[model samples]
Target chain A: MRAMVYRGPYKVRVEEKDIPAIEHPNDAIIRVTRAAICGSDLHLYHGMMPDTRVGTTFGHEFIGVVEKVGGSVHSLSPGDRVMVPFNVYCGSCYFCARGLYSNCHNVNPNATAVGGIYGYSHTTGGYDGGQAEYVRVPFADVGPSLIPDWLDDEDALLMTDALATGYFGAQLGDIVEGDTVVVFGAGPVGLFAAKSAWLMGAGRVIVIDQLEYRLEKARTFAHAETFNYNEYDDIVVEMKKTTDYLGADVVIDAVGAEADGNFLQHVTAAKLKLQGGSPIALNWAIDAVRKGGNVSVVGAYGPIFSAVKFGDAVNKGLTLRMNQCPVKRQWPRLLEHIRNGHLKPNDIVTHRIPLEHIAEGYHMFSAKLDNCIKPLIVPNAR
Target chain B: MPSTPYVSNKPKNTETREELRARIPGWGADLDPADRPSYPKERLDPSATGAHWDFPERQAGAEGREHSIEHEIVPPVFGTSVPLKGFSGAIRRHAYASYSEGRAAHWLLLILGDRVDAWESHLRSLASLRPDNPVTETGVLSERRRHGIASRFGVKRSDINHQWIDPLIVGAPWVAAGGAAVVVVRKLVRRR
Candidate 1:
């Protein structure tokens, strides 16, 4: 199997490797029909994560066909088309019962009492990831979402991770009607988070990022209010002015470690901080939100120890919610939205390259070239 | 649950005070090789209590009777326990490994039911292992509870042959009821 492998920080390569197989009874093997590079993948590729090995396959967001299943598996079978979430989870565990599948105990059996995840880490359970021709899925019943015939793989692919993460960020943000939602980093996840907030009835949706291209893309495609961080010397002040001199009701930190911001600064400044870098947007959100507001982080960060500010969070009575990705909870609803024509996340795919040119796609996406927003790797066809 | 004396059946061996100190180096110093203990075959008995601690019993073919030395403590598998508050009804509760020790211990209490007293005793015994100060005891208990401290006496003690220990506190009756008098106390500690 040919898969994209990470060579170094900001270096990725398309190389040949053995095809992944079903290792556990609840496992299933999926043939990658369509896969895309997510912001989280960039974290691993850029060496932001510690202990990320070179030559490990780099991909978590994908949709594929079931090629095989273990004897204990009953929810899915071969020939079924499914969208596999980046994080594998057992549907029957305590976390799963609460729809917190990303923290499933059986998925990353190698982790600290938490099971493994594909492409995550040794601390995260060291499962072989899905960026290849074939990917192994643990706890197949909960992780794989069956795609409706009306939905194409590209459209349903977001259900795997990106769209689900976005929706989860919005849901975690608790974007009630008439609330103003602001999302930092208008990357694919942030864009989806903004769109999900808009769908969930946020009166005004604002997105902030350093990339003017991404900010423009969110504004033009999703009708989101935009702020380019480079344009404003004081981002917090700018975001506050945009929200009637008040902060956002909810802020989604879509930019995890891959974000080129001072993580230590965020830990010291933001009271209720998320892992990874000090999300520059979180500082703005802390200044922007009402006395009692929420902040949802759906960014990719390693499991190694990180610091947070508790005093600021307590003072403002802010609620902080973060997770790997709530693919299990929101994937079904996202697929329904896609089937109903209410969501068109495929529009985020500004570049679609043949899988043969995966190496080039990685370079272009990393460089943010050719108006690239979300790039998809079509394995069989262009 | 009472703390069971960690006893083993093996042969007795002769040792000087220095040799005995080296065997259980609870204090972080190296044992002098010249002060090592020895056992002659005539005096060796494989079925005696406390004989396993004798270092020479390991050298004899009676090592099987000797308890394996390095015991790795497996942390507890914590389930969810919500504060019952004024209402005793069982609401849908969710547990995570990310929860605090007190929260996890509360869930253990709910599951242990009539055995709560026994479990509390076990926790107290574990607590007794702490220094004399109550403040230090509270801090240690809070840390262990968050991590899910398991008692071999409360449940089955892990064997020397076992690599992993099941820290799950089981046998609690998850029942339904109206209201009960309960109090929830929150404290601050180093966050993970």
Candidate 2:
């Protein structure tokens, strides 16, 4: 099997590797049919995340056919098609019992800090990712949901991370019937988040981004008003003006550590490595919302410190809820949305590259070249 | 000559902060205008999120079936007290008399004259509760130390995490003890 091996920052190559065998009875070996390049994968590619060891695979968003099943994996069998969640969790853990699958206590020795994530850096438990011909799916009974016959393979691939996480971002906003929602960043997650916000009963949704292409996608796909932050004197003021000067009821930071707004802050946080990834997006979110508003952060940030305005958030009496989306938990509702024709997760996929060209895929996605919103990796593509 | 501290003409730290606010547009942007923060910048170290496997992959059974015990989860250790409590009274005394070197094997039969589970759980509880060495006092690991050595090397825990469990398990002559305990515990729970 050929797997995407992470050599270093800006270096990934699909190399021949042993087909991952089922390590446990509850595990299954999935022959990956499709995988997506996630916005967060850029964090690993840019070396923003810690403990990103060399030689590990670097994909999490994948859908596949179960090629082999462990004896204990009764929920699935060989030849069944399944889409594994990005998380690697034990369904029996305390966190899993409570539907907090992303914070599963049993999967990672680092579970005390972060949950186990497939193909993410070591900070997320060094489970190899799915951007390969074959990948091991852990806790097969819990994490991998069988792809419904109606769901497209690309849609199933997106659901593994981006779609579910975006929907979860809106769900975290706790949106009221007529709440106004603001989402920062027009990336794929933001696009899905804005689209999902409407499903959550948001009366008005606005997406803010510096990029024109994504903002256009926000309009056409998300069906929401869009703003380019660079065009305005202050994006927050514009948000306040749009919302009757009270600010939005909920603001989601879809852009994580690599947001580009403040020059010095970006340099110190992203370049100098003095702090964690840039806090600019999160800070902008805190600044843009109403005093008692909710801020939903689905953006991926490093474990290191980021200089944030904590005092202002405290003073404003904010309700902030964030986590890596427990993707399986959101699947039922997301499937319903897909069935009802409210969402088309696959529509956002702009490019499909063979597994062999993952290096080029990573480069194009990272450099924001070719207007690549979401790029899918076809593992068996010739 | 070196006694005098160098107080250059540059402004104090407070002035530097003020100058930054005047220079940077979004410096104090979102904060309450009426309530100005006295400090401009402060170094913050969030709790270090430890996400590393300090050890290599577990060398497993030829076919990879007999993997580490990190995946074998015990029932919820919280909300449920240990089933047997008096496990400590004999296990501790005999452990000191025999395996006091903290040898990872045979203390149970020598001391409490029982399986490794009771002795292991008891010793673990003791280790967690205020050992003279301050480092041994954390209760969080009580939940962790419960993982089967195999699971630590195999299932729930990643193989890459520091495999102190491997040495700890291999060093012991009683490798099968924990696995036996699992069967016993599962059967006991099923009967209940």
Candidate 3:
């Protein structure tokens, strides 16, 4: 199997490796047909997430065909098309029994303290990610969502991570009928979060991002109002003006742990380190939320941990919920929405590169070139 | 030129000073070193002067399943109790111990024990009873200090070393025996 191996910090290379076979009775081997670079993967590319082992295949978002399955995997069989979730979970466990599948105890026995996420670093579980040619899918019966024949690859890909993350964000925000929601960052997850809020009957959805293309896409495809943080000298004031000075009922920070933006654009960039999704946006969301409002965080909080202004959350009496969503829980509903034509998350795909050009895709996506939001990498590239 | 003051020689309650003396014994024995019938090394300890260290018998039934008992030391208000009354001896009817509540308390205590000082402080601040500060009994904290253990000086309970509560409580021999209370106060003093 020729797979893209994470060599070292900020370096990924296409390497030849043996195809993984099912080692456990619950395992299944999937012939990965389509895999994409996740926004979280960019964190790995830029050296933000350094815990990913060198030479480990680094991708968790994919749509694949089950080539083989162990005896225990009765629910899924060969030739079934599926969307794999980012986290591998055993259906049985204290957390799993309570429907908190992300923190499933049986997934990674070694690093068994916190939740286990696929394709993440050793701290998560050293499970080789799905970015390779043929990847081993653990807890196959629980992890993979069986895609119906009607849905295309693009639609299925969204369900794997981005769409699920967005739905998870909306779920966390508790988006109900007529609720006004504001989402930070118009990246893939943010857009999906906005989309989910719309589907959940949000009265108004506003997306905040600096990129002109992403902001425009959020308005056009995801049905969100837009705010470019770069344009407004005071984003809080700008967002407040839209919400009648009461602030939004719900604010979702899809950006997690973004370093300050230093991109020769604004003076604020100097302190922020990067012009991307960040925890500062979380602080902003807290400030921009109404009293008793909800704040849902679906952003990938990288390995970096720092101080946060929790007093703002406390002062506002805000209900803040954060977790790595169990995609399997939401995938079925998202797939139904996709099939019904009520949801079209595939419109976020701006670039589709071959698996060989994954490195190039990473560069373009990180640089925010060519209106890229979610770039799909067709590994087989037929 | 200075004469040392007289020091009292009371056997201070050194209960929480958990010492790992016994290695995991072969098959049949009480897990706790303190509860063991007797170890040869107990004769050599300076503190064991005239104190017969009677270790409990390793209670193993002939069928080979070893049975051991452990008492969870919870606050009396929180602890489960069986009322036996009439001011006279009667048939003692025992109550079934709920493992679920015990498990919950066990986890809660593990988490609470991690910041016992903060909990102690909070309890003191909230309670109507303004308990007096601990009389710094010199021998209790200082004997270990005289032996040059840095951990002996820290009054903050979180600063004390503890393994993951599960393995130590379940697999290891020691059992939690009893409880104690202390007081802490916050004050601002003017420095001359």
Q: For this target, which candidate reaches the highest TM-score against the unseen true structure?
A: 2
Off by over 4 Å in 2: B1-192
Worst 10 residues of 1 chain A by lDDT: A266-275
Evaluate all candidate structures by whole-model CA lDDT and list the values in order: 0.55, 0.66, 0.58
List, residue by residue over A67-96, the lDDT tens digit for candidate 1. 999766777889999887776655554555
Best-first order by lDDT = 2, 3, 1
**Candidate 1 structure, TM-score to reference:** 0.63
Question: lDDT tens string, model 1, B1-192?
Answer: 322112332112223344423432111111121111110101222221111111111111221121111112111111111112111112101112222222433233222221332233333444565312222211222323222233212322112112121111111111111111121112222231
DockQ versus reference, model 2 = 0.01
How far residue A345's Cα lies from its native spot in candidate 3, in Å, is 1.8
The C-alpha stretches of model 3 lying farther than 4 A from their native spots are A110-113, A259-278, B1-192
Clashes of each: 17, 13, 12
* True-vs-predicted CA distance for residue B72, candidate 3, Å: 21
> For model 3, what is the C-alpha lDDT against the true structure?
0.58
Q: Which stretches of candidate 1 lie over 4 Å from their true place?
A: A113-115, A261-275, A305-310, B1-192
Instruction: Write candidate 2's Cα lDDT for A107-179 as tens digits.
Output: 5532245778888854465578889998887667778878999888888888888988887887778776556
Chain A, candidate 3, TM-score of 0.93
Residue-level error in angstroms, candidate 3, position B118 = 42
